[model samples]
Target: MQSTQLSPRYRGLRLTALAAVASMLAACGSGGDDNGNGGKPNTKPAYIGAVTISSYDGATDDLLTAGLGKDGLASSTAPLPLNPAAPTAAELRRYAIYTNYRAIVDTSAGGGYGSLYGPNVDAQGNITASEGKVAGVEYVAYSDDGSGQQNVTMLVQIPTTFNTTQPCLITATSSGSRGVYGAIGTGEWGLKRGCAVAYTDKGTGAAPHDLDTDTVALIDGTRTTRAAAGKNAHFAAPAGATSLAEFTAANPHRLAFKHAHSQRNPEKDWGKFTLQAVEFALWAINDRFGAVSANGTRQRTLDQDKVLVIASSVSNGGGAAVAAAEQDAGGLIDGVAVAEPNLNMPPNTGIVVRRGAAQVAASGLTLYDYTTTANLLQHCAGRATALTQAPFYTNPTMAPFFAARCQTLAEKGLVTGANTDQQSASALQALRAAGWEAESDDLHPSLAAFDVAAAISVTYANAYARASVTDRLCGYSFAATLTDLKPAAIAPAPLASMYATGNGIPPQAPVQLINDRDPQHGPYLNLPSVSASTQRADINYDGASCLRNLLTGSDAAALALQAGQGLTLRNGNLRGKPALIVHGRSDALLPVNHTSRPYLGLNRQQEGVTSKLSYVEVENAQHFDAFIGVVPGYSNRYVPLHVYLNRALDAVYDNLTAGRALPPSQVVRTTPRGGTFNTPAPALLPSNVPPFAATPAPGNAITVTANTVQVPD
Candidate 1:
């Protein structure tokens, strides 16, 4: 899931097909919008607002982008300490940032943001339109940086009939990457189960552009501090590719790592934007639509006080949801739900540390430095001799290239000697230089495999640079190979954009801080440090200068804040709310260890909160197959967990309103459907792995005492 696969731009065909099916099923289920409420409904009044809502699109003119801040100026407070080991509840409150919010949509006008629901369907696929209706509305949140407001679209679905006559439960959902659109893509079966479900496109939906990259620019800002970095300085375009994702994949520049940490603090943080969207939706349901009832009197659409929010995302979205809800010290949301969340920005640091690759690069340390070793070693061994070996050396197109590099290594005694990290770096430098300069724009799909070679080679080179120079001079080398280190084969952009997100708080565990030098990266530093490696590298730079600049500023105080914030919630600061954490046991992208343990511990340790948290694991699942469309036969043929998730939502609602204990967690077992061209042959998992079991973590669960929680040292 971490590796590049297909871009979202390529999902058009699949999305269209799925949409058609969903539409037909919805139409068949809904009883033609006629027999819904107490009587035949009439057209609603026009929305009285400063901006007019339009159909959702990527461009500004095609979307709604008007709204005034109800609370005036945004918060300008300094942020919490970068990575507090344990933050008090008061500290969290002090640093809790918010955007001036209000319901920008005039729901009383017309059809209320338009309906996206098809006729609702029963288990028998029977039409039941009168059961529920899904409506989408657009609103704007004032930017904290005083930038023009950001437009957010929300989808609200209310069951036509509820078990209780008072009103349906108000439940809002947030996803990590796809935005409001993705929240609905998972099927509305849960929305049909007697609740008003609301979701939003994190501010990125304001204009027509890729939500992920546009967001990167929004946070990083367009003004380039270094003119020498060039036109695409902040985010260099890949060779000739205009698309952002393509540029990132084709040229994995060092600056790309900075994208995750580039998100602005205070208002423009995407997480705050997402949470505000949910908050605004809840407000609209209560203050806007609920203000003018069906008969015109003030009657609510759903029980305003009984709001429960849930989140499930491929990466950071899940964590953002929890952070938002936690920061909502107003107690707006009653509960929380999370899927495999990206709790850490430069993820997999522990593994990198354990593997002796968390080296402090002269250019500044980075998780990518670790990945450069981990991924490459996973594919090719650490032998300089491997260069002359069969797989790569024998390929007709690659043989000549390998033969030349092997010769260079032989001349330097790098291949036949101990193959030290320095030697590995030098040998790789020779090979990569020849390959990148081949003058072939025609990239092969196998480039990803080649990328492994490049990454591994750089790991050694980075290690050498770290050791040979002082901490300030650490960075990318001047060699052309180190400068232009992309693979010859092209790859699609990574499935999800990495983000720096968290529920504002300290980490529950001791993370590998910027100064924490692992065995592989060399001696640790006792004080705050800066890297001057970028300055030296740029002087002799032959590669992408944009990426090169990130090396020097890699450990900047702001960068540390961005990376640290992404993992804040992983330390078990749940704010004493009932919660559920679900993860796929086989999720290659976000390991379960990263999401489940600390969260479960925090809740379980809290006396009254223990029963409020539940953790579930799905067996034989990958990250994507569980959410969006299936990947055919490579893993699960289909993800059948919506019913289970709905069940979790029900448990959450019960715990919130009725004071009932949450259901025990369990392993949701799955069977592999391996056959067609789309499907790979299914293999059984190892016995050591648990098969979707949620029996709480062993040992005493982590407990938060007086709002200050402890983490693993």
Candidate 2:
């Protein structure tokens, strides 16, 4: 559905980014140090030119490959080419460029550099400068809205100096704005002769913050000269709001409030103009790139080749829209890598893949919300940091705030609240029985909705709440409406397909990455947890900026991958780049014993041409302490970018983007086994890889070529 709702910030941001070109960007990270000046640029002469499919006939391509599955794609990279398409600067500028990586925590510099300089790391192990491009770094943001997201493409460029192209290798990154396919593959340290590289989110924040340089000026500009924009930047604060979510969370206040004097009068904020723009960046090579053959080479949409997609569990939020847009998108997609997918269809309901709350309120879904709720009554009732006195999740002083939210939603029929229960003793008792503990669990859409619904209902029914029964249910201050998870069957189409999400990643997925070690959080390591698995912080880190954030935020694992410790497909054909690591057997997160297919579809489209892959997981490392947390002493096997960059680029060149095979990352006893989380032991590796060679790539691109072996039919 088209939304008339618009966030004026969007307009302000675009104009701001455009204006920023002339202005200096704000310095960030480690007092603004390490902007790629230290590393020597790889000046080696090599093949560099691009070749793209431009476009392909979907009827001819998709129809033929849709049913071919994985086997067909694995073997097609036998011959390939090397060329670099010179996309105009204007064309490239439209992409959301990762301007810079900075750090934002602790004793200074930025986290991006902490591994080499600060208190963030003690060992500063020889991860290698190449592997650690920008770890613990915060990304500088720049948005480009023109990248045609509906189409999959493989752009390859070879160095002009090197004309002869035989087995070349390449690697690439996928822009989150689009989708990720053929993520970086393994097999480097020399393999695949013609390898290339590509790199995304490079920043840390909610919904790719300051996406445009203009946003800074747009916002800062509005602060100074709104008259120039002619009030186009004149947006209102939430009517009766006293503070921004940021402000409210910082300063204590009562959680409950009536919607008074809305800034837009009756209109609501519809979120960032994501519907208009999305960003993504990646490198593709090898068979993943256009295939290099004796007769030259060819490129195709990623879907035309055999590839697998790294599920955007943190970003796509179960891409209900992807499904809705599928037919309309035609050949745009093939297989799907949906991590912790919401599979909302009624058909997907009964099995209970994973269940969380729906339609959470602003007061309970974000640290901002819960913190606001915690503070809402504090100052009003004369208390400071009241919730801090107890486990914030179980604070007693904040009960009234929770009561407020519950009552408000109940009268509106959005939920069953204090008055709920025609049958179950008193509604208040029912809430208590439902696990009301005064503290907020807004960490996820699952728990947050239930918490906020209760809070809002309580606040509205208060003798003084400035609300009405007739207020529109469409208010955007928070997630008001949500899917009912009771015994009721999920509705098909619209209901199950509704474009909305609530809390965090389904569950086990988070723990899979965290991999705890203790039973005191007991059964740590391999299992998922409430804190580490949060979706709000992963995909959306707009709340704060800290290099430590990259490690703790949602998608923490995706952002902090150590070599040998990542999610991997059981089959050898797949690639994992910008790799998001997960442990296998994560019942609380992704479905067990199954390989997702988002990338495979892209591969089919590209006719088995892609140079990268993104997700890698260990076998059976579910919420048991085999992934993340405080375990110490042992070096995290999760390959830091420094160590990974060298080998990854090599793999991308020969194996990933190029469609060859390179050496796999070495799996070692890396993760710790105590403290908080334990790392999964020796990451899983594919057994069916073809006979491969460590062929180098043309120039500086990554490369890989797997050992030749028969792919299963």
Which digits, one per residue and each the tens of the lDDT, describe model 1 over residues 1-713? 01112222222323334323322223111111122244322222121112222222212111111111111112123333343423332232122111101010111101111121112334233445332232333332222322222323344443333222222333333343223334442224333454445554443221111212332222222122222333222222121113445533433321221112112222124455555555544444343333232443333332234344454333345666655655666555556665655443223222210001221112112333323322222121222343332122224543333333333344434343333334434534432322211111111112222432232222222222222111212223111111123212111121111111121111100111121121223222111111232212111111112223333345553244334334342334556566766665554334443345334544444433434566675654444432222222333232333334444555555555455566455455555433443433333222222233224343212223332222221
- For candidate 1, the 10 contiguous residues with the lowest summed lDDT are 503-512
lDDT of each: 0.32, 0.21
**Relative to the unseen true structure, what is the C-alpha lDDT of residue 379 in candidate 1, on a scale of 0 to 100?**
21
Off by over 4 Å in 2: 1-131, 134-338, 346-713
- Cα error, candidate 2, residue 346 (Å): 5.3
**Against the hidden reference, what TM-scores do the models get?**
0.46, 0.29
